[model samples]
Target chain A: MSHPGADRVRDVARLAGRSARSKRRSFLAEGPQAVREALRRHRSGTPTVEQVFATDEALARHPELAEPTDGVTLRRVTADVLAAMSDTVTPQGVVAVCRMLDVGLDDVLAGSPRLIAVLCQVRDPGNAGTVLRAADSAGADAVILTHGSVDLYNPKAVRSTVGSLFHLPVVLGVPFADLAVRLREAGVAVLAADGHGDADLDALQDASAARRLAGSAPDDEGTGPRLEAPTAWLFGNEAHGLAEEELTAADARVRVPVYGAAESLNVGTAATVCLYASARAQRR
Target chain B: MSHPGADRVRDVARLAGRSARSKRRSFLAEGPQAVREALRRHRSGTPTVEQVFATDEALARHPELAEPTDGVTLRRVTADVLAAMSDTVTPQGVVAVCRMLDVGLDDVLAGSPRLIAVLCQVRDPGNAGTVLRAADSAGADAVILTHGSVDLYNPKAVRSTVGSLFHLPVVLGVPFADLAVRLREAGVAVLAADGHGDADLDALQDASAARRLAGSAPDDEGTGPRLEAPTAWLFGNEAHGLAEEELTAADARVRVPVYGAAESLNVGTAATVCLYASARAQRR
Candidate 1:
C-alpha cells in the first residue's frame, strides 16, 4: 500500500465514521497496542482482526506483531499510507480493521454474569471507554451500553479502552425498558449509581465486609441490596446523570459518598468505585 | 469588550499559554460551572476570580451569576469577542480569569492531612486533571504534582477538572526528593500505587475493615502500613509508571488489584480506588 490516496486506504479510513462502520460491520483500531490486542484476539479464535496494516518501523519495534496469524492479513504500508488510514494524528504506524465485537445481551445474561456495568445515556465516547476499561479491571462479566449511549465503536472510545475492548464482551444499543426486566429475570439486581441516592456505597461495602468477617452469608443481614450479590450498575450521562425513570427501574439507587466539596463524581470515577466495590465483595 | 481584536481580549486569550499564565500568575476558567465555582471561592474570602466575561445570553440564563460581588469585574462581551478571549471553540459564553491556586508543600503538610494524591511525572493534561478530580471525589485533602507532571493550569486540564480545581488545595512543581522527606516528617505514610506492588489495596482495605469491625486499633495486627493512617498515595506517569526511585522512596508499594484481563488500571482509576479506600478507612 504505497499510495496514501489509494481506494483501499480510503476504505479503511472510512471506518472512522459511524455510517461507514455500521455498513461494513467493522471498525479501525489504531496504534500498536490496539492492533496487537486485535491480533491476539484473532489468534485466540475470536476472528477479531480481518486485516492489520503496519509500517516497517512499527513491525521492527514490535516484532511480536509481525508473527502471522491464521485468517488475519498483515500488510506493510508506508507511514504516510498508515497515517492516511487512521483517525488519530499519530496512529503509531499501525492500524487494524476488526469486526464489531459487541455480543448479544441474551448471550451475556446466559453466562450468569456476577458483575455487569450498564451505561445509560452516557454521551461521551471517552467516558464510555473509561468505564469499560474500569469494568474490565474490576473483572466485570460484561458491559452494556443502552440505547442513546455513545457508540462504543467510536474511534476515540476504542482508543480510550486501551485494548480492554478486546478483553471482554460488550452489548451496545440496549433498551432500558427491556434491559431492566431482563436483568431482574436473570437474578441480577440493577443498581442505579446516583448522586442523590438514599443508599450509600461505603455503608453497603462495610456491611458486606462485616458479614464476611463474621462468617455469615453475604445476604444474611442486610434487607437492602448486597454488594456481594449478582449486580448490574447503571451509570448515567455525564451531565444529567441517571434519569428518574432509570433510577426508579433499579432495585436501589446508590450514591458514592463525597466527603469533599465536589458537587458530584465524574461518571467514570464513580463507575470505577461502584464496580470495584462489587468486584471485591463478590470475590470475597 | 465588544471588539474581538482588542488588546485586552488578546491578553486574556494569551493565558492559554503556560508562559503567560506563569508570568501573570493566573489562568483562564472557561464555561459556567468553573466560573461559578471561582465566584463562589471569591465570595467565600479566597479572592480567586478577578474578572468574569460573559455574553448577555449567558448572564440571562444564569441569573445567579449576575449577582453583585465585591472586587469582581463583570463585563458583557460579544460572542465573537468572548470566543477570541477563550481557549475552547465554544466557551459556553463565559470565562473567568482566576488566580494561580497552587500552595506550598510546607503549608499543605502543616495541616497534617489524612489523605493525599501525588502525581509523579504524569505528562498528559487530561490525565492530570482527571486525577485531581478523582482525588476531590475521594475527599482527598491535597493533590501534589511532581516536577515533571503536566501543568494543571493547562486550559484542557482546567476544563477537565470541571470546577473541582477550586474545591481543594493543590501543590505543584514540588521535587520528589523534597516531597518524600517532608511527607515522612509530617507523619504521613507514602504509598506508591504501583502495578507490581507487593501490598494489595483490597487486602489492605479488608484488614482495615476487619480491625474496625472487631473494635481493634487500625494498626494493631498488621506489620504492613494501615490504610486508616494519614497517608500520601504516589501515582506515576501514564506510560512508564513510577520510577525505581519513586517506588523505593515509598514506605510501601500498593497495587490496586486487577481482577480481570486488563493489563493494568488507568492511573486515574487506580488513584480513585486508593484514595477512596484510605478515606473510608480513616473516616471509620
Candidate 2:
C-alpha cells in the first residue's frame, strides 16, 4: 500500500461531480456503508468496484472492505487523500470507485418483477436516493428512473441511499412509454401515485384483504388490480406532480389519503408508504 | 411597501445560522411554500410571522402574501435583497421571518391527542422536517422532540418541512423522562419504532383487526394496546436507534419488517410507514 500520487488524487476528486463520473464511467462510493456494499457487490461477480482507497485505521476497522477479486485494487492513503476524493464535508476514511450499476429497462422487465418504482422527472437527488432505499426495503424487484429524472449516480444521491443502491437493480434513462408498455406486457399493472386521484389507497387495501379471505382473486370493476398482484408504482417530480399523459397511461391513479392539515407528503415519503402498503398486502 | 435597508438585509440573513437565530428569537422561512404557511398561521392569530420580504413579482403572483394583519409589515425588496436574505442558492422571491412556533409539551398533552410522533435525539434537519411533514399528514395531533435533537427552527429543517411546520404543534427541548410521564398522564400509549423490536407492525395491524372482529377491546396477551388506541410513536436517531432506557419506557417496541435486501429503511421513511399504519388503523 502506498500514498496516492497527486495526479491520482486529482483524478479521483473529479468524480465528485457528475461530468467526470459520466466521462470516466465510474462513481465514488464514500464512507463505510456505501463502500462495504460496493465491495460486497463487486465480490459477488458484479464487477462494479474499480478500486478502494482507505486509511490504515479504516482498513483495520473494516477488514472485509479489503476483499476484492479480479482487477479490483485496494490502496492505503493518508486521511487527507480520502477526504480529497470525498464529496461530503467530513470523509469517513473509506472511498470506493465503482462503475455504474444501472441496467436497461429490458433487463429489469426480463425478470418479471412483482414490484417496481417508476420515478418520472424526479429532480431531487436526495429524494431519488431515498425512494431507491425505500424500494429496496419493500423488496421491490427494480427501480426505473425515466428521462429527466435526477442522475442516479450523482454523489448526493448515492450517499443518500446509504447502501440500498447496491442491494437492488436500478434502471436509468428509460423513456416513460417504454417503461409503461414493458410493465404492462409483463402483466405488472402500473398505478399512478397522484394526489388528486379518484381511488383511495385504504379502500384498495381492504378490498384486497377481503378477496384474499374469500379464497379468490380480485375481479372487481373500476378497482384496476388487487394489491397482491404484480404492480408498478409511478411517482412524479417534487414540484409539479404526474403529467396528464403519465397518469393516463396508468391502470389506476390512486392517492394516499391525507388525514391531517398537511397538504401532502413529499414524493419520497409518499412512495415509501405506497411501497410498504404493497409489500404488506402481498405478504398477506 | 419599500426596499429593505442594507442593515435589515444583513440582520435577516443572520437568521440563517443557529446562534444568530437564538439571539434574535426568530428564524427565516425561505421560499413560497414556507412563507405561505407562515402567513396562514399568522392570519389565524397564532401570530408566528414577524415580517415578510417579497419582490413585486412574487407579490403579484401570490397576492395572498400581502394579507398579514395589524403590526405585520410587508416589505418589497429587490431580487438581490431577497437572495441576500434567503439561505437557498436560488431565492424563490419570498422569505418570511417568524418567531419560533414550538410549544410546551404540556400544551401538546393538554390537547387530548389521539396520535403523536415522539422524536428522540434525531439529528439531520431534512429527516426531522420530513418526520414533521409525515406526522402532520398522518393527522398526528402534535410532535415532540426530545433533548439532543436537532433544532426545530433550523433553516434547513423549516424548508424541508415545506409548510407543514405551521400545521400542528411541535414541542422541542423536552427531556425523555418528562415526555414519557406527560404522555402517560394524557392516556397515550407509547410505542417505540425500534428496528430490533419484538413486535411486528403487520402482525399488530392484523391482531388489532382480529380483536375488532371479536367485538371486544384489546386484551390479548403480549400485544399491548391496539393501534387505534391513542398512541405516541417514539423514533430514534439516524445512526444510533433509541437507547435501551427509552425502549423500556414504551408500551411495546414494534419493528417494520424489511422484506428485501435493504437492511432497513432510513429513519424518515420508517417513521412515515409507522405513522401511516396508525392513521389507517384508526380510520378503520
Please, what is the TM-score per model?
A: 0.98, 0.95
Q: Model 2 reproduces what portion of true contacts?
A: 0.90
Give a tens-digit lDDT track for model 1, residues A1-284: 44444889899989999999999999999999988888888898888999889999999999999898999888999988888899999999899999999999999999999999999999998999999999999999999999999998989999999999999999999988878889999999999999999999999998898888889965557599899999999999999999988998999999999988899999999999999999999996
DockQ for every model, please.
0.89, 0.76
The C-alpha interface RMSD of every prediction is 0.7, 1.3
What are the clash counts of all predictions, listed in order?
Answer: 0, 0
Q: Name the DockQ score for candidate 2.
A: 0.76
Model 1 C-alpha lDDT per residue in residues B156-188, reported as the tens digit of each score: 999999999999999999988868888999999
Compared with the true structure, the alpha-carbon lDDT of candidate 2 equals: 0.87
Give the Cα error of residue A165 in candidate 1, in Å. 0.5
Candidate 1 clash pair list = none
Q: Give the TM-score of candidate 2.
A: 0.95
- For candidate 2, lDDT tens digit of each residue in B174-246? 8887677778889999999999999899888776655555557555544465788899999999988999889
Q: State in Å the error of residue A269, model 2.
A: 1.0
